[model samples]
Target chain A: MTENSDTLGATEKEIMYATHHAMVKSGYAELSISRISDELDKAKSTIYHYYDSKDALLLDFLRFSIDRFESTVNTTIGAHPKGDLDHIILTLLPCQLKKEKRQLHCVLVNIMPHALDQEAFREQFTEIDNRLKTIIEKTVRRGVRTNVFRDVDPAQAAEHILAVIKGAMCTRLTTNREAATARARTSLFSYIDSHLMA
Target chain B: MTENSDTLGATEKEIMYATHHAMVKSGYAELSISRISDELDKAKSTIYHYYDSKDALLLDFLRFSIDRFESTVNTTIGAHPKGDLDHIILTLLPCQLKKEKRQLHCVLVNIMPHALDQEAFREQFTEIDNRLKTIIEKTVRRGVRTNVFRDVDPAQAAEHILAVIKGAMCTRLTTNREAATARARTSLFSYIDSHLMA
Candidate 1:
């Protein structure tokens, strides 16, 4: 057993990234310290030196990954200053890396069951979810005020947008049908173009 | 340790219903044959007599529940001749049993992680999900044909509607906030009323 630390330094960040990559490769069910070490090319003992158990490492890893992911979204949102709403919506989408990889959002969803058991993860997830929705709410409100969008409640519009993304992602995750997923995604934007626009 | 039966009879349906009630009460994690037996006021042997184990019974119960639930939705759809689109959309909404009880849909979602392991459950769930979505697709197409809806692609529009419903249900499941859930649900209908209408 080792002492659990609250914050991650440079080395800790590397370890968390290793854990995430390992989780992405195999999934959270088979995630282990040994595997994380293998991914990072670190000895198992050295990896265990910073964390007491798999659970502790995973909890911290979830927090770290979520923080990093949120910051990236914030950066994307910030980059598009008064840009097209479609591009902003596109920025929030989960993407496939290649024939091999997917975005971290998909990986997080794969371990959703595990997160349900962690009180801290649930609280953090709720907050992160709300913040993400808030960004959309602001965007929608801005669109409405600028006469780009119809008179719609920003919060409800935000909720619907999130739902569309979630539902589309779930469809893709389950079916792995690119065409069907694309249709779902495209339909959302078209709905926005037709309905949400003033 | 025992033979797995292929079909369930009336008694078996009753037993499955008991298992569902028990699941709704204690959730999937705490669900057991003994708990189901207690719920039904039957001996454990009685349950074991029909099914080999909890997993087998649950698989069957999921199939049974899906069948029954689809029938109810189909019944609701059939009851509406020249039905309003809002009524059609309302037919697909998830329900709460009472102030204290939620419908079994939430229970199914609670066990979603477990379903990933079972190929039967995954297949059945996917098929059932597609069928439910198909109902919405047909409704949207009918609306478009009758000039009640905009000329939207039926499949894509269906996907968006299902996504909204799924996203809203997921929110309700996670937040348990009545106001937020209602807002999410209402937004979808309003979106249709405003955008889908010709």
Candidate 2:
């Protein structure tokens, strides 16, 4: 489990790209090698040559997405722990996502149910959840240590904040309601201002 | 639109029952009329007489689910506003769900992605989200009025609480992580105790 997209081969990169588009267009349940190859404008044999099945390809795509997400966080944020936390909250809100990223979010949301039945999918999703939780946990710990945030339980606070992020994202995605996310963002930042900031 | 399960006729009730079992077993994506009929142990024509297609059947099932959920909340809770709030939170937590109810939750999670592509599904899901939010909002308002809860923005508080409920459910369902929900439940109850209670 490497978090380096740079390590992927050229063909692997292409497959990931095609898989993204295919998932965005047809969703996870409808996604197939043929649909991915159609998106790639290449032979299905090309995808089959590298990956044995759709689930394998999807797992790779999930890893690729995680790598991209990590790189984005590392490069775009981290100026300050609080800023990083706020930026992550905004980024996770589905309303703030751009078209392509939103499609990616949609597909990830789509794949969540499959995780119920597929152990491989469940493991990868578990990793995804833990990785995100860990990131938030680290930031909270750093903030508390630096005295920028009030003395608080970093793990518990991180869980609460991540809950708001996940809840806002799910509300927006599942309901397609803009007001829900708006309210959640307001409530979360208010908590950070009142309870978290020193 | 009506939240009365009693309005359903005998065959409609039977169909809803069969649909519930079918969805619980096969899931929404794999669900078909044949599967539903198989669950009913009846001819395909019998189901077709009630539902024109799978989507129609699913739409009714969604309404049926909402009705059942509403009845459960109304009957099981409502002794007092604060107690109702706590009970709703406990009810929405997937970890607290029984086996059959957990299967129903899984199917609802499965339907969320399909709602993205299908407008009717999207509308029904929006209703589900709003209905839940509204229930919490009303409870919060009542609690505040009765002086059981601290003076707070009822709508905002409701949204935040609902976010925690949803976030906890999604975390449990997607990652199959017990620790996450346990932490979430602790964080949420702590928040309610410190922030909301009078």
Q: Among these predicted structures, which one has the highest DockQ? A: 2
Q: Write the per-residue lDDT of candidate 1 for residues B49-157, one digit (tens) a residue.
A: 9989877787777677766666666665443223644665565554443522344655555555544445665665576567667777887888788787888788887
Worst 10 residues of 1 chain B by lDDT: B94-103
How far is each candidate from the true structure, as Cα RMSD in Å? 4.9, 2.5
For residues B1-198, could you state the per-residue lDDT of candidate 2 as single tens digits?
435457778998999999888877777667888888898899999999988887687778888898787666555546588788878877787456677787887878877887877777887778877888888889889989999999989899989988988888887877867788888888888887777889
Please state the i-RMS of candidate 1. Answer: 2.8
Give the runs in model 1 whose Cα sits over 4 Å from its true position: A1-14, A37-56, A77-84, A91-103, A114-119, A175-179, B1-7, B37-54, B78-84, B88-103, B114-119, B176-179
Best candidate (score: lDDT): 2
Error of 2 at B134 (Å): 1.6
Model 2 off-target regions past 4 Å?
A1-7, A22-31, A38-41, A76-79, B1-7, B24-30, B76-80
lDDT of 1 by residue, A1-198 (tens): 112234678778889989878877886567788889999998988777888888677667767766665555565444332354565456555344342234455555555544334555455556556766877788788888878788878888888878787666555554323565567668777777776778
Query: How much is B194 displaced in model 2, in angstroms?
Result: 2.5
Model 2 lDDT tens row, A14-110: 9999888887777666788998999999999999999997778877888889877765655544658889888778777744567777787787887
Best by TM-score: 2
When candidate 1 is compared with the true two-chain complex, its DockQ is 0.39
